[model samples]
Target: MGRILMKGNEAIGEAAIRAGCLNYFAYPITPQSEVAEYLSRRMPEVGGVFLQGESEVAVGYMIFGAAGCGARVFTTSSSPGISLMSEALSYISGAECPAVFVNIMRGGPGLGGILPSQADYFQATKGGGHGDYRLLVMAPAGVQEAVEMVMKAFPLAEKYRNPVMILGDGLIGQMMEPVEFPDELKSEPSNNDDWATSGMETRKSSRRNLVKSLFLDSEQLEAHNRVLKAKYDRMRREEVRYEPYNLEADYKALIVSYGTMSRVCRTAVDILKVEGFEVGMVRPQTLFPFPEKAIEEAVRRESCKVAVSIEMSMGQMVEDVERSVRGRCPVEWFGKSGGDVPTPEEVIDAVKSFVKELI
Candidate 1:
């Protein structure tokens, strides 16, 4: 297919359709309403369904309804709305239903101002929902990542039978980028009537497929948790995705970051290299299954000593950085929460300070 100049939100909607997600349920929210609006137009053309639910709460349940039927489903929102949907998200994860979610992050604790921020890092990765389940969260730093991850999210969610999230800040959601919709895309499964209650009678099968997350018995719930934990354990080993740069040289320090902040960190590495400091960066693509081993390897590099974790939020990713180091190297943090993004120069300043401290 030809490259299309697309806004991030529109790209996400098209990508979802291309990836075979046919059922979409959403409540419009800033920096991401475009996603829902786009789907409302596109899904109908594909003979798919786009439903505007009564509220965010109902929208989440709508996702549950579609996903429980073994259909490809999706929803999107910003910070506050995501929080409102978290309870249902937990239910979907516990039920082990395949679904996709997009969070165009904005500032937050309450109705925090929406410009661009990664304040929902912990919520997305650490599972803010009230249970021991993790959504596969993909952080897209650029518009291309937005589309690609949205495509990848479908298979990943189905394979895991868990909700997958494409987490982007406002800039990535609102910005434009060249995107190529793959020529080899396939339509979603229609045989979900095999399990879905679409009211097609005269079916011969007596075995009914009931999908529910409710496990009231304590022993059974514990066993269910253990099984999910095993899946997550496997994911930690198999899905630790990251991009490293300037890694071959002798480095006095390394910077760890992700999403938009990682893009700036890359620029900082370039500028620092122009002078004298040997620095590198590790940008995590999958935030839930953190690139811990990658971080460890970079920390163990001969040229590296101190590592700094930078983010658009204050010290959220720093937690992972510290865990990766395991006290072997000094891990530091520099970030601005609440709708602020640091420039390359600011990152360079932080990196230089770390180098100076090491010297």
Candidate 2:
């Protein structure tokens, strides 16, 4: 198919449909409402189901129920709305249901603002709700990447029998870009009969499938947690993804960023390069199984005297960067929050400041 100029939110909605997601339930929230709106019109034409629930909390369980029944399902929301759905997310994780969630993040600690922010880094990569569970979190840098991530989320969720999330900022959801829908991602319903709650007749044996997170017996629950931990460990080993920019040779410093913020940092890196300062970047594509090893190696270069985290929020992702660098070099952070995006010039200045400090 030919490339078309598409808004990121609409592209994500279309990608979900193309990915064989037949059921969607979401409540409208700023910066991400377009996904719900776009799906509402398109879902019926595709012979799929679309619903705007009364609340984000309601929509989350709706996805859980549908996913449990072997239906491919997804939803999209902003930061506050994601907060409302966290309880259901925890339950869905515990039940090991395959569902996709898209969070087009806006500013927040409360009803903070309706603009792009990466403040949810800790909420997403760390534990948002409860328990020792992790969501396969993909943070895409641009509209095209967002579409690809949304398309891939369904299969990854089903493969692991766990929830997956597309973590994008408001800029990504609001921006327009040329995108092509790949024929390779076309639809076919997932074969989930083996583990799905598809009732007695669908089962090969007479055993009934039950999907629930609650296990009153402590021993059984502990064993289940061990199995879950093993799955997470496997994901860490096999699913870590990242993109390196200008890392082919030594650089004076390393800039670590993800999602939309990385795009800005990339521009800053270019600006620095022209000024005769070599700065490479580590842009994490997957946030949960964070590209720790990649970041570690990038900072390990002898020329990399400092590593800086450039984010849209006040140092949330910096924590992860610090964990990865592990004091190999000095770690620093530069950010803007509450709906404000840091410009390339601003990031360049921050990098210069770090360099000056080292000198």
Candidate 3:
């Protein structure tokens, strides 16, 4: 297929279809309503199901229900909508059903604005719903990456039998870019006879599969949680992904960021190099199972004096950055959480200031 110039939201819908995800449930929300709008038309043509639920909460459960039936399912929403769906997310995780979620972030705490913000960092990487559970979160820097992540998310979710999240800011959802849906990413849904509640009649088996999260017995619940923890640990070891820029240079300061902010930081790193101030950046593609080892290595570089977490949120990701750096060097944060993206010049100044303090 030829490269198609597409809005990020539209591309996500198409990508989901291409990934063999036939069931989609969503509630319209800003910066990403286009995804629902696009799929409403496209899904029918593909002989897939498209449903607009009454609310985000309803949409979430719809995804859960479909996934429990061993179907490829997903949903998309912004921050507030995601919060409404968090409870269902917890249930899906507990039941160990494979599902995909895409959050096109908007400024938050309360209907903050329709503009982009990465404030949901803590919500995504940390637990959003009740109980201890984790979502395999991927943050994409551009439309192309977002499309790729959406395609890849389904298989990962199935592999782990857990939900996967694609985290993007409003800019990523609204921007138009050239992208081709790679054939390598296309695949048929895996057989679910082993665990799916799809029905014994369909699989022609006597073994009845029960899918539920309820465990009234304390010991059984603890054992279930331990099993979940093991999967997460395996993910931490196997799924960490990141991109390092200018790490080859003997940089004085290392900047860590992701998603749209990483794109800005990349520009800042380049400009600082031209100005004879060597700076490096590590952009994490996966938020959970974070690129901890990568950042630890970058900050430990001999010439690196400090690690700065540059984000669109106030300082959510900085906490992870500090944990990753583990006191190897000074760790700091600089960002605007009020729907304003920090520009390359602002990032350059922040890096320069950090470097000056080191000198």
The number of the candidate with the highest lDDT is 3
* Residue-by-residue lDDT tens digits, candidate 1, 1-359: 68889999999899888888888999998878899889889999999999999889898899988888677889999999899889999999898888899999988879988788898999999987999999888998898788888888888887788889888999898889898877465445535545544444544566676777788999999999998898788888877788988988788888998888889899889888889777888899999899988889888987787999999887898998999888888999999877768999988888788778877
Model 1's C-alpha root-mean-square deviation from the true structure amounts to 1.9
For each candidate, give its TM-score against the true structure.
0.95, 0.98, 0.99
Off by over 4 Å in 1: 184-204
Please give, for residues 1-359, the per-residue lDDT of candidate 2 as tens digits: 78999999999999998888879999999999999899999999999999889999999899889989888899999999999999999999999999999999999999999999999998898978999899999999999999888888888898888999999999999999999878786656667766789777766657777899999999999998998999899899989999999997579889999998899899988888888889999999999899999999899898899999998888988888999998899999999997878889999998989989998
lDDT of 3 by residue, 1-359 (tens): 79889999999999999988889999999989999999999999999999999999999999889999999999999999999999999999999999999999999889999999999999999989988899999999998899889999999999999999999999999999999998899877888999999999999999999889999999999999999999999999999989889999999999999999999999988888898899989999999989999999998889999999999998999999999999999999999988889999999988888878879
TM-score of 1: 0.95
Residue 279 error, candidate 1, Å: 1.1
Q: Score each candidate by Cα lDDT.
A: 0.86, 0.91, 0.94
Against the true structure, what is every candidate's RMSD? 1.9, 1.1, 0.7
Query: How close to the true structure is residue 116 of candidate 1, measured as C-alpha lDDT?
Result: 88
Task: Report the Cα lDDT for residue 207, model 1.
Answer: 64
